[model samples]
Target: MELITEGIKKAFILIFTGDREIFEIMLLTIRVSGISVIISMILGIPAGLIAGLNNFKGKKFVISIINTGMGLPPVAAGLFVSLILWRSGPLGFLNIIYTPAAMIIAQILIASPIIAGVTLAAVQQINPKLKYQAMSLGANRWQVLWILIREAKLPTLAAIMAGFGGVISEVGAVMMVGGNIKGQTRVLTTATVQMVRMGNFDIAIALVIILLFLTFAVNLVLTLIQQKENITWAQRFWR
Candidate 1:
């Protein structure tokens, strides 16, 4: 109880006073996670949508692959990335290890599968007949696709939030890839680990509080959108 009170007081002071290091670390965390979210959206959302909407050979296999990827261990991802970026490795020439770029790469790897899996689940729940109906109604491929995506907005937003949460809380992958370098690749999760090692409990707790707040905000927005739509499982997900 005493520790919690002290930590809260310190957190308020640090935030109110605009502690430079805290601000820097927080901004860097946002940058890494935001970029990762964008990358995940690009790689995962579209693929998930396609997988969900289309029927093809090996489609289930592909979805299974994504589902498996969602549970990938961050430490393993970091190790694999490290190996690939080593001097004699195939991607070594890019020289991305132990840097912010590496952190971004790690985060993208962590986030993409979650985004894809969630989106795929949402997509799969939509009615197959909707696609046929849309096509029969003179909706061109582009138009039909747009309608389906727009209808899926609420679930899609949930998937995006899930992806964001998965990446922001990850520590092992980023730490391994970035080496947790100070003033360079330090992010909230990794910074918290470092702070703990240094006995800076107050700042670590503060960061945790902010992280929790962010997760809550993201999930709240997603739920709010879903509620506003007032549609059934796939009804809002497919036009």
Candidate 2:
């Protein structure tokens, strides 16, 4: 209990005093996690939209695969990504096995499936009559699909934000792929681990505090989005 109290006090000081180490870790965490979410959105949303609207022989199987991947173990994702970047691996020529790029790749693998699965679920929740209503007016297939996507915006945003949350707080995959190099790949989670191991409790706790704040901010923003007041796009989505 004493150790816990001391750690919390030191953590508060580091944050209040604006420690450089804590700032750096916070910045890197935001950068990598933000980019990872963007990458997942670019790939997952379209695929999920297509899966949601189209009827293909293997479509169910493909969606099932994505749903399964949504829960993929982070360490396994780390190992698979690490191998691809290893010196003797197929992508070894890039020589980026233990860099931010590697960490981004691992995060993309972990988050993309989640985004896709959630997007698919959201799309599925929409009434079939909505699509039928659009098509009845002589709208083409693309038009109907676009209309559905617009309507499901809120849930889709929630899915993406959820993926972002997961990636930002992730420790295992980033550490394995980024190598947690100082001033280069040392993100919040990795930095926290190193600080604790080295008995630098102040910095570790500070990083954790920053992480909590950022996560809280993200959730608060998304929660506000839940009420589609000024979010007219989401309003259109809900209908």
Candidate 3:
């Protein structure tokens, strides 16, 4: 209890003092996770929409694969990315290992599937009649897709939140690929782990607190957007 209290106090001190190391780690964590989630959104949203809206042979198999990926282990993702980025490995020429880019790639692998899976479910829940109605109105394929996406925007925001949550809290994959190099690739999760291993419990707790604050702040913004959208949608329905 005393340790936790002390840690909480230390966290405030670190934040108020504008500790450079902590600030840098927090920023890197946000940058890596933020970029990963954005890329995942660009890739995952379309893939999910295509998979959900289309009727093709082996579609179930593809969805099953996505579902499997949604639950992929972080360490496994780390290992796979590391292998590809390893010297003498297939894509080793790019030489991104042990860098923030490598961490972002690993996080994208972890986050993309989750976002895709959630988006798939969201789009699939839309009424089939809505698509038909839009088609009857002479809406082109792209127009219909846009309409459906708008209808699913609320849940898509949820998918974004989930993706952000996944990548922000991730440690194993980032650690493996980034080597947790200070002033470069270090992030809150990895730093927390490092502090813990070094028996710096107060610092570790501080890192965890900062991580939680980041998570909460991001999610709070997402949730506000979602609820505002929901309210607007409800108003439209009532009209």
Candidate 4:
């Protein structure tokens, strides 16, 4: 109880004091995680949409791969990313190891599959007759796809939420690839781990709170977007 109280006090102090280090870590965390989520969605959405809409001989194999990746262990992802970015590794010429770029890469690997799998489920859940109807209305292939995607906006928003949540809370892969360099690649999740290992429980608690608050803030915005119509309708009724 005393520890919790002290931790809360420290958290408020760090936040109210506008501590520079904490501010930097928080901003970096958002930047890396947000970039990762965007890359994942860019790559995952089309792949998932194609997979869900088409039937092919190796479709199951592709879906199995996506499902496996969704459950991929963060440490394992870290190791895989590390190997690829190692000094003598195949892609080492780019020289991104131990950098924020490396951390973003690892996070992309962690998040892409989850976004892909969830997007597949969302697209698959839509009624097939909608596709037929769109075609019957003289919609071209691209138009049909756009319509279906718009129809699945709600579940797609859920997919965004899941992907964002996954990478924002991740630590292992970022720590491995980023080397947790202060003022460079260190982030909230990794900072919390470091503070705990060094026996600074108050700082750790503060970092954790910041992390939670960040996650909640991002999700809150997404949630508002997701439920905007419902909220508007409720307001009209109460008016």
Best by lDDT: 3
Q: TM-score for every candidate vs. truth?
A: 0.90, 0.90, 0.93, 0.92
Tell me the tens digit of each residue's lDDT in model 2 across 56-89. 8999899999988899999999999999999899
Off by over 4 Å in 4: 230-239
RMSD of 4: 4.4
**Residue-by-residue lDDT tens digits, candidate 4, 1-239:** 98889878987898789889988998999999999999999988777888888789999999999999999998999999899999999888889999999999999898899888998999999997898898999889988877777777777778888989999999999999999999999999999899889988877887888898888988899888877753343255374
Q: Supply candidate 2's per-residue lDDT for 210.
A: 90
Q: After superposition, how far is residue 144 of candidate 1 from its true place, in Å?
A: 2.6
Off by over 4 Å in 1: 230-239
Residue 166: error of model 4 in Å?
0.8
Candidate scoring better on TM-score of 2 and 4: 4
For each candidate, what is the lDDT? 0.85, 0.87, 0.90, 0.88
Rank the candidate models, highest TM-score first.
Answer: 3, 4, 2, 1
Best by TM-score: 3
lDDT of 3 by residue, 45-151 (tens): 88888899888999999899999999999999999999999988898999999999999999999999999999999999998789889899988998888788888
In model 3, residue pairs whose N, Cα or C atoms come closer than 3 Å (at least 3 residues apart or on different chains), thus clashing, are none
Provide C-alpha RMSD values for all models, in order: 3.8, 3.0, 3.1, 4.4
